[model samples]
Target: MKNLYFLALLIGFNLSAQELPNLNLLNLEGKSVSLKNDFMEKDKIYVFSFWATWCGPCINELEEMNELQEEWKKEINIEIIAVSIDDSRTQKRVKPLVKGKEWNYNVLLDTNQDFKRAMSIVNPPYTIVVKNGKIVHIQNGYVPGNEKDLYEKIKTL
Candidate 1:
């Protein structure tokens, strides 16, 4: 029982220590925004989702997020901001692709990779849930039913 308690404490500490780095990225219109400022506040939780145009899983995850965004927002004051990791050369494709998909979430461009490196994210379809400027959850590789889990996390915040 004592070992079990120690193990649980270690897990809790590790979870709380995992943090998302501060990053500044540009929006589709070329305006700069700080991830720390834009996504977090004293009273709000932000969902920062990183994706790329070339990744099929990323596209599917964003589509799933869009479908559930409204309902999620109504229940919890959560906002999902989609960040595209496509480089500047391929940046032109982002707007049209997002538009074509009819995604209603806020979209930004991370063409310079500042955000990706800050979050230590090497793969597309990564998500970090931030609350009060601290990371609460970090997930890589999206699965079809993962949004339910995400929603539950957001609801708890």
Candidate 2:
């Protein structure tokens, strides 16, 4: 019975993890944006990158993506949304960091972490690739050149 229960739970988690949590997050401009509704462009790929201001690897991932975004877009119908997981105290740093770096990403602020909790994301630099309102790929952590792998995956979708 215990083994069966565990299997059931595992299956349930797996299923939920594949779908984007229907939640609204605030963008850097302080506008509420629905992850599912607002971003649901038919046949277009959406890359949601979760990052925090303090995380070094997260910064690296976003910077790399920002640099490659234009070139990637020419080849794929893709959009990159950087979701900042910074809480109230650190939230102040988000805009300046993005502006200073001059990143072209659509930056969203997950101040209360509602979106993060709903998506079961545990760390920064966690990326999700979605299409037609469904999550098609996930990269849990970032290493140098991981963006290249992510770009390849997006091309396949």
What digit string (tens of lDDT, one per residue) describes model 2 on residues 2-91? 999999989767753577778888888888998878899999999999999999999999999999999998999899999999999999
TM-score of every candidate: 0.85, 0.89
Reference-based lDDT, residue 128, model 1: 86
* Residue-wise C-alpha lDDT for candidate 1, range 1-157, written one tens digit per residue: 9999999999868766766566777776778887766676676778889998899999999999999998887887788899999997878899999889999978888888887887779898999888877778888899899889988877777
> Which segments of candidate 2 are over 4 A away from where they belong?
1-17
Q: What C-alpha lDDT, on a 0 to 100 scale, does residue 156 get in candidate 1?
A: 78
lDDT of 1: 0.84
Clashes of each: 0, 0
With a 3 Å backbone cut-off (N, CA, C), the pairs that clash in candidate 1 are none
Where does model 1 exceed 4 Å of error? Answer: 1-15, 18-20
Tell me, by TM-score, which candidate is best: 2
